[model samples]
Target chain A: MSFHEKSNLAVLALLTLVFGVYFLWLMPQMAVADPLPPPAAVAGVLIPFVLCLVVLIGVVHLVFKLRDLKEKGEADERDRLIETRAEARAGFMLALGVFGALTLLLAGAAPFWIANALLGALVLAELVKGVLRAIAYRRS
Target chain B: MGKGKTRIANSIREQRFHAGEMTQQQLADAVGVTRQTVIAMEQGRYSPSLEVAFRVARVFGKPLEEVFSYEDEA
Candidate 1:
């Protein structure tokens, strides 16, 4: 696989693992009795910590890959074009997701639901972006 | 911008072979693209931009038309 493809896979895996684990941990708490836990108390600290760890791992992997392949010919015109297109698609999804979240809030959903909806939308957007990137690499 | 089909085909593979059995990586470096991009072009899976197409032809010391051809699907 190309380096960019490998990088994309690693990022997708990291995002999935980190957020998947967070959601699993939050599930029981989310079901707790009324007066829902403050979003910060429940996930704020853990989210940042886990995200930092995942980002660190990705950066380290990329550094090593770059060192191993000094002449990696990183991200030429075609690669850049593919990435731009993928991000544009992902951005559209993200906008729609946020708008949906706002609609839910306006319709009187709990703050907890609104927050989770936003998070879900963010994750889905990133996932879509990563998947589209992988497809572009393979097909184009 | 569309996917799954291309109107351009190229003989980059044959040209690379003639040029001292050049590797894709080397050609990509010379043409300012990734090796995978060169592979895609050779397989007729991805069409390069005009700029990249000209660069590839220049790398091979040939004319753009000599390296790539247009096949209208109309």
Candidate 2:
């Protein structure tokens, strides 16, 4: 697999772990708390998100150092093909997410919810596409 | 994805060889693309944009037709 593809995989795994921890397991548990109060502040989640970003950057960079950049030739025909397909798939995912965002807006959803939802969808689509590309490259 | 065929494959290949067995990287640097893009052109796996194609021909000091020819099979 190309270095780019490997990084993409790492990013997807990072996102999945973060999402599971914050959304599924932790958020649910928080909602069940006694006399559950609203979130401490809008910025409370910023720390975790920043930490996740740092972890992602550190992990991928450590995994694929510049020493691996010396692959004798230009990425061969196979690499090009893989890149083309990966890019196309990712583009479609973005388009789909954007389309969903449009529908929600047309339905008169709250502006804040519409914007945040669209952003989340974009992030998720990117995560899925990265994972898909990495898996495909590894298999090949 | 196969939109248009390259017409000057042979000429481009020959010029690259004549210019001291020019490596793809060297040509790519001259033509303003990544080495991978140059390799694609050399192998006939891609058809570059007209601007790039013109740049490539100019690099060889040849008319565009001198480097490329049309072939139905390709």
Candidate 3:
């Protein structure tokens, strides 16, 4: 795999693990919590989640850079093309996610649920982009 | 419209052999692409842009048509 492919795989794995744990913890609370969790309470989990994601991604890139010190990290034409294609598809995923979030709002869902839905959509879009990129790299 | 698989074929491997067994990395560096791009071209899994195709041919001192060819699916 090229450096970009390796980096993509690492990020994909990280997003899966981080968000997987988050949703697992949050989903159970959604059913039982009366009045739903406050935004501050969600932020309690989200703040840490964002922090961990940012730190871990930084570490991943740092390791990759260390492993390939000579690499200038410049993306070539092929990399740009693959990324553009993946983003194009992922854009549709985001739109669908946003539509779902809007639907939840119209149905009188809790703000907590609507917020999480939007977050889920964003994360899912990113995951789809990563998967598409990986596939493009493997097949082409 | 339905998309068809890439039908562009290249003789990068053969040309590399003729060019003193040039490494994929060398060709990629010379043509300003990644080595995986070079590999994809050699395996006929990817079709490069016209500029890249020209660059690759230039590196081997061959005409563009000599390096890459297209096949009609019909």
lDDT of 3 at B52: 97
Please estimate how well model 2 matches the true structure, expressed as its whole-model Cα lDDT.
Answer: 0.65
TM-score of each: 0.88, 0.55, 0.93
| TM-score of chain A, every prediction, order shown | 0.81, 0.63, 0.95
Clashing pairs in 3: none
Residue range A79-105, candidate 1, lDDT tens digits: 788889999999988998899999998
Highest TM-score scorer: 3
Query: What does DockQ come to for candidate 2?
Result: 0.07
Candidate with top DockQ is 1
Q: Write the per-residue lDDT of candidate 3 for residues B19-67, one digit (tens) a residue.
A: 9999999999999988988988888878899999999999999999999
Model 3, A9-109: lDDT tens digits are 99999999999988887656664788788767887878898899989999999999999886667788878889999999999999999999999999999
Residue range with the least summed lDDT across 10 consecutive positions in model 3 chain A = A24-33
User: Model 1, range B1-74, lDDT digits (tens) per residue?
Assistant: 34775878788999998899999989988988888888888888788889999999999999999999989778
Instruction: Show what share of the native A-B interface contacts model 2 retains.
Output: 0.00
The local lDDT score (0 to 100) that residue B30 gets in candidate 3 is 95
> Docking category for candidate 2?
incorrect
Candidate 1 segments whose C-alpha is farther than 4 A from its true place: A43-46, A53-56, A63-67, A71-73
Structural similarity of chain A in candidate 1, as TM-score = 0.81
